[model samples]
Target: MTAKPTLAVVGATGAVGAVLLQILSQRADIWGEIRLIASPRSAGRKLAVRGAEVEVTALSEDAFAGVDVALFEVPDEVAAAWAPVAVARGAVVVDNSAAFRLDPDVPLVVPEVNAHTVRTRPRGIVANPHCTTLTMIVALGALHAEFGLRELVVSSYQAVSGAGRAGVAALRAQLSLVAGTELGTGPGDVRRAVGDDTGPFPEPVALNVVPWAGSLREDGWSSEEMTVRDETRKILGLPRLPVAVTCVRVPVVTTHSLTVHARFQGEVSVDGAREILATAPGVVLCDDPAAGEFPTPADVVGTDPTWVGRVRRALDDPAALELFVCGDNLRKGAALNTAQIAELIAAEPA
Candidate 1:
């Protein structure tokens, strides 16, 4: 039997944070005492865990004093500021932010692929891949192992939830407006007017798709696009991995889906990728286009694994593989991944 480990969940009131708390409660065998920490605004809020409620406390420098593992589900700035502090105090930090994903010392881990990186805690801080990279790697990692992946051309149909809790609210608000007046904004939902409609993005996300996911980088690529490209290399340990990513925000509220076309170094049959995805950890295969059975965001919400379906061999190109994948952005995409990292680290003393 594995020894239970003391856990501290930072940002316990956020969207992904709440899911982390729930997943932890569901897996009691992997946890000991659990501490829920959030911002001062959310401090003292009560959240249920294992059928009982726990108080959410404001995270401080001393929050990690006696913790064995700390799962960070907050924004990058919060993780950047507190992750090192927690590590210094003694806890291993599993961060679900983009802050340290590209840090040379930090191992951006996807448990299904390079979980060994989590075991070797050289930096005391480990990164969970971006929600997009998280699902893409699960579907592709098996193929990368069976036949080395050389290039990836990915176009993501990401759910609003991928942007965090705010993204969810934005979608619902816009949907209500569109449903009422065919994309007419009401006076009441002011947030939908200013920021979402060409404010945060160049155009409104109501009943439409936004080509950008994150803020612009100096290189013209959005931050979300860069994350998908960089984090894939980190998890797959393939530096110089050719990846072209276009991230778009869809109207859905929970699951994020990706259409990936990968060119491999060696020959890979579609049947081979199918067989590998069937048994791969953290992946659920659903490729049956003829029978109308394929993974969909509607079916993937609340599920823990990345659902891969719509598998096909590329037309006019044998080495190129095309597939569709969807995973709950709030679950497997963010919170569950963080909790799983903490669970894995807890199994062995950090």
Candidate 2:
């Protein structure tokens, strides 16, 4: 490794990819060459990074030749096919897709939780956790380190942006159509208003919430729900931790919020929980209900750290704690985390 590494941002034209570019430019400099790669349609387009214009190149085998680190933000299928090619070309791939997250050989990492695992990547690839899991696990992982977490019951209020640009556009269009109308008053009114414009959601996400995200699985759990369970376990190193999750799509444009009830092996307290989160890396403690303080998607959008509030210990259960957390699904949940991981790799000893 050198003092500065050549970096490649794959899928540089998508939502997360655009955010990743902004994050890279805003952060400190540790990269040599920053290459932008996208599909043929986006090739030759100019994107501003680090205060300079960079031309997007079509993703190809030659694109990875001199790339020391490749940060992928493409679809699962695209990543599954191209990541190995990048790795074969000698670039360590930090993929932000689900394709390799559960692969035993690939390290699914959150730098705040399991950064040391970065060096043990047997396949020269690291997987970023799902945006929902990334949203809450920073604070949860901090508390788990102290209280020894045993189980989790979590419900997520996710924004439309989690589904990408189309999700955002659909929500905006529906909101506009129903802005001054009476849609939420009757059943199917909102759906009828936003006809054929639901975008990536199964139903209208304006003036109402959908209790589903991701594809339905055989076990009745949405793929989004299952990701929260599985990714939390992997990141926390607890395979049998007993996690239950329900994912809901809210009308918000960005940020994902979660209400978590965590059970620990030992007794816990509200003050202790507050103290841990106040000092935890990648966490911001914003709990003060008297002054009307709590983490909300409105307050967390475009932010970096995971905002945690409403910290309380279960009244009847001394070994349990309850809290609310919010994170920008596009920032810490995806882009910044991968950027941090790539920086970690850049700092590795030569």
Candidate 3:
């Protein structure tokens, strides 16, 4: 690796890709030449990065040449097919896709938690954790380092944007449809009101909450629920840690919120947890209920740090803690985390 690595941003036309570009522009200039690559349909378009307009190129073997680092934000199938190609052309891939996350050779990293693992990528790829998992892991990673996590019971209130641009468009369309009308939660009230406007969601996201995210699996858990459980364990390096997750689609536009009930080995205290999170990097402690202060999606959107609040020790169990966390699904949850890992690699290349 050279002093200034040549970087490539794959899927540069997508929502997360846009956030990645913004983050790149905000950070120091550690990159030399930045190449933008997207699908054939998005090719010939130009995007402004670091005060320069770079034309998007179609993904091909030539595009990967001379790229020292490739950051990807495409779908699973796309990453599965193209990551090796980028690696074959001698670029280290930091992928924000589910394709290589669970692969044994690919390391799933959150720089705050497992920055050291980025150096051990046998497949020349590092997978970013699920957005929902990234939302809570920064704080939990700090807590777990102190308290030793044993189990987790999480219920996620994910925004429509987690489903990508289509999900956001669907919610906006439904909100427009029900703007002047009375929409109820009764049988098919929302379904009829937003007919054929659910986008990628299973139900209307404007007037109601969908109890599912991702495809249903044979074990009755959605793919998202499984991703949260699996990715959390992997990022924390706790393979046997028991995790139970329930995913729901909320009406919010950008940020994702989670209610985490964590059980740790040994006794835990609220003051200890608060003290740890207060000083932890990439985390903001926002707990103060009497002042009507707690992290919310409306306030946390566009922020890079995970906001943690409503933290308390479980009354029935001294070793358990309950907390609420919120973060921008696109920024910190997806783009920022990947950027952090890539920076780590840039700082110390193999």
Better of 1 and 3 by lDDT: 3
> To one decimal, what is the Cα RMSD in angstroms of model 1 from the true structure?
3.1
Spell out the clash pairs found in candidate 3.
none
**Model 2: per-residue lDDT, tens digit, 1-350?**
87778999999999899999999999998899999999999999999999999999999999999899999999999999999999999999999999999888999889899898889899999999999999998899899999899989999999999998899999999989999876699878888988975899999999999999999897799998888888888889999999999999999999999999999998998898999999998899999999999988887899999999989888889999989999999999899999999988898998
Tens-place lDDT digits, model 1, residues 174-220: 66655745334454343454354543445567767779988889778
The TM-scores, one per candidate, come to 0.93, 0.99, 0.98
Per-candidate RMSD, Å: 3.1, 0.8, 1.0
Ranking according to lDDT, highest score first:
3, 2, 1
Error of 3 at 180 (Å): 1.7
Candidate 3 lDDT, 198-304, residue by residue in tens:
79998888878899999988779999999999999898999999999999999999999999999999889999999999999999999999999999999999999
Q: Which stretches of candidate 3 lie over 4 Å from their true place?
A: none
The global Cα lDDT (0 to 1) of model 3 is 0.93
- Residue clash pairs of candidate 1: none
